[model samples]
Target: MGSSLFSIGLTGLNAAQAGLVTTSHNISNAGTAGYSRQSTVQSTNPGLFTGAGFFGEGTKVDTIKRAYNGFLTNQVLSAETKLNEYDTYSTEISQIDNMLADPAVGLTPAVASFFEGVQEVAANPSSVPARQSMISTAQSLVARFQNLSQRLNDVRAGVESQIKDTVTSIGTYAKEIAELNHKIAVAQQAGSAQPANDLLDTRDQLIKELNQLTRVSTTTATDGSMSVFIGTGQPLVVGTNATTLAAQSSRSDPSRNDVNIITQSGAAITIPENLLGGGKLGGLLAMRSSSLDTAQNQLGLIAVGMSTTFNAQHLLGQDLNGNPGTNFFTPPTVGVQRFSDASTASPQVDFADVSKLSGDDYKLTFTNTTGGYSLTRISDGASVTAANIGLSITPAATSTVGDSFMILPTRNAAANIGVSISDTRMVAAAAPIASAATSGNLGTASISAPVVSSTTDLASFGTAAAPLKLTYSSGNISGFPATLPVTYTPLSGSPITLAAPVASVPYSSGMSIAVGGVSFTLSGAMQDQDSFTLGPNAGGVSDSRNAVQLGNLQTTKTLLSANGSPSATFQSVYSQTVSAVGNKAREVKVNRDAQESLVNQATQAQQSVAGVNLDEEAANLIRYQQAYQAAGKVMNIASKLFDQVLALGQ
Candidate 1:
């Protein structure tokens, strides 16, 4: 009986010791990375002989197993991937916005300066210094355009480089995943309780990283190996082999390189999974074409419009020494057509000087909805019609070679007709040449002398009939009727004589005219409409003249109409640019919010199944302790029984 009692007590002591050891093991690995707490499952051993009725042997440990949920672990990895991708894309777009919107460091100031110079020249038409200043400002504008374009190109290059790095990282992670798959499969086959759990953790981590680079989905095979595929169901990994990713320039444009992932055996695969909901690389690609390229092209288009329009006008008008044709701005090439280039050329058309030639000498050619124009010039009481501008290149004997001339093309509101007149020079009357008319001239010449009579001549220098009548059909001058003639005229209004000669100089370079019943201001301020408008009494008038005058050369906003109403040509481009910017910003905000919500849901799901629980571990510890105690009780009972038998023998 003492032996039996001692055996029972020893069983308790052994059981207590085993239970303590199990608890310690669990505690030790609690802080270990990727270590799942282990549990000892106990079961009773079978009885040796049970023919009649026999009690079972003490409990034994069935297996030490890890507690894990595959679905929960996968959910965590997937969430992490999406979070990284969204975060990456958001950061890239913010950078793009910063680059574009930067004020002092960007193109805005340069554009402003160019227009300001134009305004200054317009306000001071006769100032040579002002004209020169305008030219310098124009050059600066072109330089800024080139600089901005280069910076954008650099951003594109950086994105390509980043894509290459990302692809390399994807390949590295892919290889690691393949290796871990092999390890896990091997562990399963070997019947190990761990089942390469740590390897699996590492694989999960790698896959999360891969997802951030691009979108991916996975399938578990029967053998426990994983098949990874990106968007469009292209396999990235199958069994032990991993597909590699590469970068190559686009087929049509070698300057742009795109990422491609394929199998080790060279099967093409659809990569750039992140592009659909891509990360940083994807964001850049999206913006590269949409915002960056489009904006640059739009800016170029603006420059093209300005240069082409100005050059067309410059080509038609005679330069200050009456040179028939000199290009105002050099014909533009594919891209470089800045207005500043037009402002700084030699013998440049002075936007400020409206006094150089006859009052009616200025001719503006307008290609309206109608095809042809018959225009008139109002200068020195002399009127030249569409039929008179093509007179002989040289003036008659009564006319000097260096006489100033005027060609006026007016669009009459009442007549609904266009008339252009070119007439030879007469000395300015009392008022300024721009506002002077027939009453201002002191000469004997009259308006009808050049166009109606062939015998009239400028007897003295200021004589009115000495000037020739030039006429143009449409915008083109067809002929000049040389009815009046005069030798060189002087300050005394005396014609050149064999005894007393006179000095004559070429006509001034700049002139202005009133079209459509309103005078269009040509001040430097007229170049840019950033802070100006042509509304009724706002800047000038409610007519089409003010609209065209206030029209922005740099911006695509139709300030005026060709037929004198509101213009639609310029407003369209402006509206389109504004819409594009707003849309991109909205898209970024929406995607960012959606991604955050998805991450939250995924995180909660992962936590529900995979998260650690201290209370559950405690419960498991107690259960394992009781089983160990039962096992020890049987062993102790056997030992005491043997001891008692030996005592009996003694």
Candidate 2:
């Protein structure tokens, strides 16, 4: 009986020692990151069988179980990922908001200044100082465009660098997680009843870190290994193997970087930008492809619209030298067209009408062999019929079916926009042609200002066939040679006449007429022998009619067919872009705040389950120490009883 008591006492002592050690360990590592509180699991040893029921033996330690909840861990990871996503998105969009809305340095002031200068030139058409000021303002406007475009490109470059760094970090995390998976599986298999709790905690911590960079979904296998996936179930880690991710330049746009997974055999699988959502990397990718890209393109659209419309109208007027005005601002080009297939004939694309531009990239594909083509606007995935928009795509006669071309209309327009003419004298401020009656005319007949109805008329003015004479007759105007086929519209007849007889129109007071593509009004009573001369304006330095029209372009609906709207002005489009970015930034900030709150709640819940508590551990330490002392006392009593029995025998 004494021997059995001693044995039970020793067993109790061993179990109590283990409990004390575990409690002390918990107290020591309470502040350690990723450390789960451990407790000693005790089980009573099988009681010895006796005729009078079973006699109790002693307690034995079963295992040390870690405090953990898988569900709560997953919740923490999800919340962390969402918070990172919105935080990153908000940070990126704020840069653009500040750029576009800035008072002193933004495009708004430059636009207003440029138009104000144009108005000044209209107020003083013959003043060289006013024209010079107009030129200076135009140059300043171009500089603003170039500076803003470069800043946006810089932002893009920064995003690319961040993406590359993020990809590297993700790859490192994946490889490390895979290595931990191997270690964990081996340890769990070797120690079957007791899992490798500390290793599991380390692995979970690494997954949380990875979630901060990009969203990841995890699955535990039966063998105690984890599999991680990202971006639409692309495997990042599977058991002991991990796939690496690389940041590569995009195929279509070399300036942009795209993410691709590198397989074990060194094969790359490109991940679409849209599929990547939730976390820092997701935010950066979304900003680059959607918000940032849209902002830059919209700015380019404003530049293209203003430059093209102003230049076209400027060309319609006469300059100080009595010559037609040249292009005032450099026109934006349809950036390097990329073709999907080889074709002998390439299509030429130009902005035929600024009012019809939608500021979207396009894809042109030949549908059939008979010169039929289909154009698709990439922004909203809207199909653009040839007749609907002003983009002119002239395909080569040899262009066959299956030929495809990518057209980026406004992507790089702002960067390429510049001042085409440096001389202020080239600024058109006068009408190309001036109408007048001869000084020796016999009648009170007078002519209105000549309007060049078409580019054909402007080019033909002052030519060998121009400066034609018109002699009034009894009932009709004569002097137009009958041999030459002429287009004449009577006062009350059809609006258009193709090659009609010159004398077919009946003369009337206040009659409108068009000859050789020029339109003018011949009003007042005319004598039978009255004559008028139609010629180009040789000196128009004092004229400001064209300058007035140029100034009017500021409020004109130049950017057209945007979002199904018939037209939009330069300021309206830019304002819309600014509003969009501001709204997105605010939205992201609110979402980030909400997500952070959720993360905090999840962390607290997780901590309650697995975190160490000093007060609880201290109590456990005291209890285990007392139990150990009592077990030792029991052993001492057993020893005393054994000594008395031996003395009795002696």
Candidate 3:
């Protein structure tokens, strides 16, 4: 009886000691991150059975249990990853938002100022200072575009760097988690299938950290090791082995960085970027794809549109040097990124029509014979055949199926754009042709200045020495070249085309006439035998008609629209870019806030289940202390009883 009492008291003492040690451990590690509250699990030893009845033996500690609920933990992790994603996106896109939307630094004011200078030149075509100022403003505008493009390029480089850094961090965490998995597995296996509570907590913490960089999922094996996966179940860690994630140059565009995983056999597998979602890496990619790339393309589109339209008009005008104006701004070239090395050189991409340039990159894949190549609009995933996208894509000769290319029509236009001419005299401010009535006219009729829509026809019509003389006879204007086409539009009626330039049967006051490409307005009545002359505006120093036309281009809808029209202007496209970035920034900020709240709530929920509470641990400390003392007292009593039994034997 004494021996049994001593054994029971000793077991009670041992159980109480375990309880104290576990409670103390919880208190000590309360501030440690990822620590789950642990407690000793107690079980009474199987009751000793006798013929009469069963007798109670002693209590034993089953296992040290970690207070963790996988469901709640997973919920926290999910919310945390989403919150990180939004936070990263919000941070990254705000740079573009502030850069494009700010009134002082934005492209809108620069464009307005450039057109304002053009208006000054139009207002005084002969003013050297006005022309100089226009040139200066043009330079400033080009500088502004280049500056903005540089900023965007810098941001892109930073994003790529950050992606690499994030990948490296993820790889490091993967390796650490793999090591922890091995450690925990070995510990548990060596300990009667019991969990290594502290090691498990450490591993879980590593997973939580890894999730911040990229989303992750995990599974536990029967050997107590966790298998971690990311991006549609791509294994990051499996038992003692870890897969390393790396960032590499994109196959289609080398300037772009894409994420991939390195396998055990040293082969790299590129992860489809769309499937990799929910973390810092995902946010960076999302920002680039959704906003950054669009902003740069839009800016470059405006640059190309402005330069192309302005240059075309400038070419049509006569400069002060009596020469047809050259390009005011250099024409922009298209950018191409090839996928393979077997290229017969990427096809030169030029703008066939500036109005049809959509600012979206086109993918040209060589299927070898679907008319040599297929063009796809990257922005919308719509197939645009090479014939209709307003791009002159000359197919490559030795292009194999392994070769593909990305045609970025406007992506780098702004950076490469420049003012082509430096001399202010090169500014085209005069009309190419002039029209006037003969001095001997006897009628109150006057002819408007001739607009030479086609310089070729203007060159063919006449020279300033001998103009095309039109005589008003009865009701017809004659002396036009018979080979050229002539059309007349009455003020209140539709245009009527004469069957042949020689057969002008009718004429009226307030009528518009087009002879070949030259057009003029005839207002008021012309008496019999009154005459007008159309010829080149040679030495017309004050001719500002073309300058006026150039000024009018400021408000022209020259930028491309989705419906295949020049529907957007330079200022409006920049405004659209600003507005898009602003709206997206606001959206990301809102999502970041909402997701952050969710993260907090989820963390609190999970913490409530597994978090160590100091006050509760304090209560346990005293409770276990008392139980230890009571157990000691029982053991001391049993010892005394045993001593008395031993004395009796003595």
Candidate 4:
């Protein structure tokens, strides 16, 4: 009976000693990250039974268990991922917002100054200094556009670099996690009664760190190995194997960097950028695809609209040298990128109508050999035929079905915009034709300013078929020539002679006449022998009509949407772009803050469940020490009984 008591007491002592060691370990590692509080489980040993009654045995230590909640850990990881996503997005987009809103460094001041210079030129026509100032302002405006484009390109480059770094880091984490998974599976499968708590903690810590770089979903197997997936179930790690990620150029747009996973067989699988949600990498991809791309395209739209409209109107007037106006600003060209696998020839793309441009990219997919192609606007996913948007696609005879092309109307416009006319004297500011009454006119007949109503009129203005003369006789004009036939039609009556020269034609007040593609209106009573001259303006140094028209383009509704419903002026579009970026930045910042709070709450909850408490560990230490001393007292009592029995035998 004493020996059995001694054995039971030894069991109690061992159990108490184990409890003390576990409590000490928990107290020591309380501050360690990812460490879960561990405790030794105890169970009653098998009882010793006798005829009278069953005897109680000491307690036995079972296995140590870690205090971990999978659900809470997952919640914390999810919140952290979302917070990181918005944080990165906010940081990147704020750069663009600041650049666009800057007073001195922004495009607003440059646009205002350029138009102000145009106004000065209009006020002082033929002033060399004023024209030079206009040219200088135009050059400055062009430089501003180029600088902004370069900055945006730099941002793109930086995003690409970040993506590469992120991919490398993801690969590193995947490799490490895979290795840890193998180690854990081996340790867990060793059939040991002890749980590998430290290994599990280290693995969880790595997964949490990986989640911040990019969103990842983890699944644990029965063997204690975990698999990590990203971007809608694309495996990053499985068991002891990890798939590598590479930052490569996009298949459609070489300028863009995209993420792809390299398979074991060396096949690359592209992950759609939008599928990657929540993390720094996802945020960067979103900024590049949506925010930055839209801003740059809108800026390019403004540049194209201003340059094209201004140049078109400028060409309608004559310059200081009595020559027709040339282009005032350089026109931007359309961008076309053909797929590498496409067999069709690249189509010719141009801004057929500046007022119809939508500042969006289009995908042209040829469906059949019948010269049929479907056009899809990338921004809105609206579908139309190529001819619907004024795009002329000339497919090759060898073109096959499924051939694709990407057309960018305004993506590169701002960067490539330039000043076409360097010489200020070439700035057209005068009407092509001048209208006046002859010096010998005997009536109150007068002519308004001559307007070259068509390109045909402007082309024939100074040619041999021009300089038309008209003579009035008995309320009739008879000086019309055969080469330049005149169409005389009354304001409220039918035309008299629209063919060759007429011997006699009835003339009335407010009569309209068109000759050689030029139209003019004459008013008031005309006497016999009254005459008028319609010729090109020889010296139009004071003409500011075209300059005024050029300035008017600043407020003209020249930009149109793909469907031609929404339209805006140059300044209006720019203002909208600025407002959009600012609003997006504010929204992302708010979301980031909210998500950060959620992460903190989740983390606290997780810590509360699994965190070590020093006070509790200290109490456990005292309890286990008392238990060990009591078990020792029982053994001492047994020893005293044995000594008394032996002394009695002596």
Best by lDDT: 3
Best-to-worst lDDT order:
3, 4, 2, 1
Q: Is candidate 1 or candidate 2 better by TM-score?
A: 2
lDDT for each candidate structure: 0.45, 0.83, 0.87, 0.83
Candidate number with the higher TM-score (1 or 3): 3
Instruction: Give me the candidate number with maximum TM-score.
Output: 3
Which candidate, 2 or 4, has the higher TM-score? 4
Per-residue lDDT for 619 in model 3? 94
Worst 10-residue stretch by lDDT in candidate 4? 457-466
**All candidates: CA RMSD (Å):** 18.9, 3.8, 1.8, 3.8
lDDT, residue 558, model 3: 85
Off by over 4 Å in 1: 1-54, 57-74, 192-194, 262-281, 287-291, 299-590, 614-634, 645-650
Positional deviation of 576 in candidate 3, in angstroms? 0.5
Tens-digit lDDT track of model 1 for 418-473: 11111111100001101111233332221110110111221221222232222212
TM-score for candidate 3: 0.97
Q: Count the backbone clashes (under 3 Å) in each candidate.
A: 47, 0, 0, 0
